[model samples]
Target: MSPKYDDVRNSLLGWLSTGLREEPSTAAIFHQLCHRLVDYGFCLSRSTLHLRVHHPQWLGTRIIWVRDQPHADEQTVAYDVEATDVFQRSPFHRVIHTGKQVRQRILIFGPHIFQIYEELREQGHTDYSAWPLDHSQGRRHLITFATDRSEGFYDDEIALISDILPLFSLVTEIRLKNQLARTLLQTYVGPHASEQILDGATTRGSGVTVSAAVMMCDLRNFTQMAARRPRDEVIAILNDYFDLIAEPIERHGGEILKFIGDGLLSVFPLDRPDACDRLMAAVTEAYDALARRSPLDHQIRFGTGVHVGEVMYGNVGSTRRLDFTVIGPAVNLASRLEGMTKTLQRPVLISGDFVKAANCASRTEYLGNHGIPGFDDLMEVYALRIDAELHAR
Candidate 1:
């Protein structure tokens, strides 16, 4: 390689090493790398990076960079993307599965070789090449480069890119691992709890007492539904039910701390002035959404109990396996109230404290004070008047 090419390679290596230490955004780093290569006189017209991420809703992510574009474009690959005909017929599949490089001179390949080559040829690209980006534990990703220049890439240019790939892979692995950690945390625990764990709140039994509106929701007849139905069908039903209930709660700023079988526990922190209002709106929206669903085999029914009080919120469990969740009488009360929904024949039951905090007395029907287990005095309970409009204040 000439001095100019050596200079370019060194500069890129320095940048990537800094990126590994700084942990910059993956998209920004990739976009900068592509532009730098172009500025160094490599005839690069387009480049793409494909990453297979460990996520619940997505299979992978694709970052596309076009020459002269100010920023790169990013798109998430869905879980079913691998099964699509387009992916099955593309060169990416070969590189990803075989852990090998693919080089195609677009002008020489017939249309039947690969659909991607045909597309590149139509876009005036003369050459296409894909390389397997290997990471730790035998995982493989993909990177591709295309050039519109008549001569395509020189032998030395390709050699330089090949030599620098290990450095690029090292930088990317660090970022991707961090991203995967966050994704797993957020998936298993709520975002707020995940942030707390990430911020070094992992000690067992460590917690804080905070005032908030808490809710417990359970699907009715779920045990019986699971008993008779096929396991796959039962799981599908549970997912659908959770989606319907979980979306509104998340949209209204409630954090779901746990999904216990067919039920979930959520909270709206009182730090926000509208916490109680948001809880009410979220429950109402969830109920209305579930009511609209018309399942073929059975009807969907659920019970919700809401209360406002102080609870211990943090990590708890054995020394080895700790769980970040809420505890104390307030959470217990919410659970008991949810159980009462079946006896009272009400879809939603609210404690008196929640009604006062939300200022929704006019919209609630007073159910006389009732004796609560583990408490001395009778507790006042109210049922939300479903006919009344409930929305965020």
Candidate 2:
């Protein structure tokens, strides 16, 4: 390598090492690297990088950098292992299967190997190169570079980039691992809880007391459904049932704390003055939303309890295991009310405090004072009547 190439080599290593110390979005890193490569006389006009990830919705992300653009663009695609016709004829797919580095000249008039080559030639790009890295786990990553210079990249330039390809792969793999951790965390737990866990609130008894509106929802007849249904059918039923309850809660800015068998606990934090109104509206919306999806035969049924008060929210468990959730008078009362739905045969029950805070007492019917287990006073409760057909269903 020439003496000028030495500086490029050092700079690439430095950038890759810096990734270990600080976390930046993958697009930002790729954009900076493209600029650096251009300054080093690599003559890059466009560059694209691809990494397949383990995710439910997305197959992977593609980061593209174009010269003169302010930043790189990242696009995600759904998982599709079956290669399409376009992919079958492309250099990227060939390189991955052959485990080789490909360098081709994009001729302006002569027959082009791929449609992209013809397009690049029309855009003044003279050379194209693709490098594919195949891992043992049947995953592959590819990086492609295009240059608009009169002459394609020289043999020495290609060798320089090839020598540093491993470093690029290492840095990219670390970023992907970080992305996977966040994706999985957010998938399994609510986003708020994921943030808490990532922020180091993992120890037992690390909790905070906060005032909020609490809701507990239980699927009616779920035990019967699970007992009589096949295993797969039972699992599917539970998933659909949870979605009916969870979708509206999250849509209205509530966070689900935990799922307890056929029941789920959710909360709307009281950080604003209108928090009560928002919570009450959200609970009502949840019922209507679920009812629309309910079967006419009344095969699926649920009951919800809404209350407002302070509760301890956070980690609680043994040293080896812990659960991040709410536990207090408010939470207990909400669960108890949910259980009452089976006795009273109502779809929803709300506390007097909720009615007062929401300024919606007129809209709710007085259900009289009710006694709760493990509580001294008889609590005043209210009920929101839904369509008779919905309740029967």
Candidate 3:
């Protein structure tokens, strides 16, 4: 390692490791890259350090492009890349497809909105170089370093990055791919005005899900709360509440199906035999969450209902807008158990079906059968511990 390369060793290594680890957040990684680039003589008048982030979506077949902070131009860096005319072309596509370094220069003769060339020309930036980073998960990215040097990318400059490009490319690809999944989630799964906020609201039916254990959690007092609060506050509260339910779902190998106002509809499907066990863990988690979530202290407190049952999994909706949710008795039982929370007076309630399958006795108390709403026969249910008692044997 030569002295010139030594200046960027820490930054380059950090980026490489971050790429490998696929750190959920790239802000800190890119922020560090910006400072490190400055240390390595990438001093341009405008925001010189820029990153092109991309990932694969639509089942690892379609590529999605994204951009991260520290823009090349302060005025236009944070603008949407999809809205840019540059994205209309296949420049990024070609680079990712070939897995090679590529450079593109767009010259605008007339007045334009984001005159980056004009800004660079005024600031004396004439030359640029870039390398592609492709992760094995069908994700590709470009780590482009631009300089104002009239001579363009020098031999040593190109060689230095090229030498480490292989390692950086491997991790960069993963980082960007994971980033792509997240970007898609934030765009599609998030509560955006245009987006439906459901995970599989768009196209579905591409993948097959084996038998899965379905769990549904319906929030109590949501209807009353929504009626009392402002409209904007309702959305804000739902977003915060969903965060609580979602983190555990993902950790326990579950997917959030939808948010019916204050309640969260979720599923835990199992290809493995142990799939039913997650119900116990999730039940305990829900109770613990309730115990910690004091309305006076946190402004939000709600009960959780859980049940386990077998069901088929697939995309369920019309051609225009399809959704991914479970279809079976399991989902209904989960909902019934969730509603029982109000009558049971416990923050978390589980169905008898879940308790029998739980196979872990002494962890829960069987609540006798009782007539439930919309049900002809009385439903049998059970209640988990309030706190300090583990659901799993």
lDDT of each: 0.86, 0.81, 0.57
**lDDT by residue for model 3 (120-150), tens:** 4554555545557655655455555555655
Q: Please, what is the TM-score per model?
A: 0.95, 0.85, 0.52
lDDT of 3: 0.57
The clash count for each model shown is 0, 1, 2
Which candidate tops TM-score?
1
Off by over 4 Å in 2: 81-102, 107-126, 133-140, 227-233, 293-299
Q: lDDT (0-100) at residue 344 of candidate 3? A: 61
Error of 3 at 13 (Å): 28
What are the RMSD figures for all models against the true structure?
Answer: 2.9, 3.3, 12.7
Clashing pairs in 1: none
As for candidate 3, its clashing pairs are 135-173, 212-269
Candidate 3: clashing residue pairs, number: 2
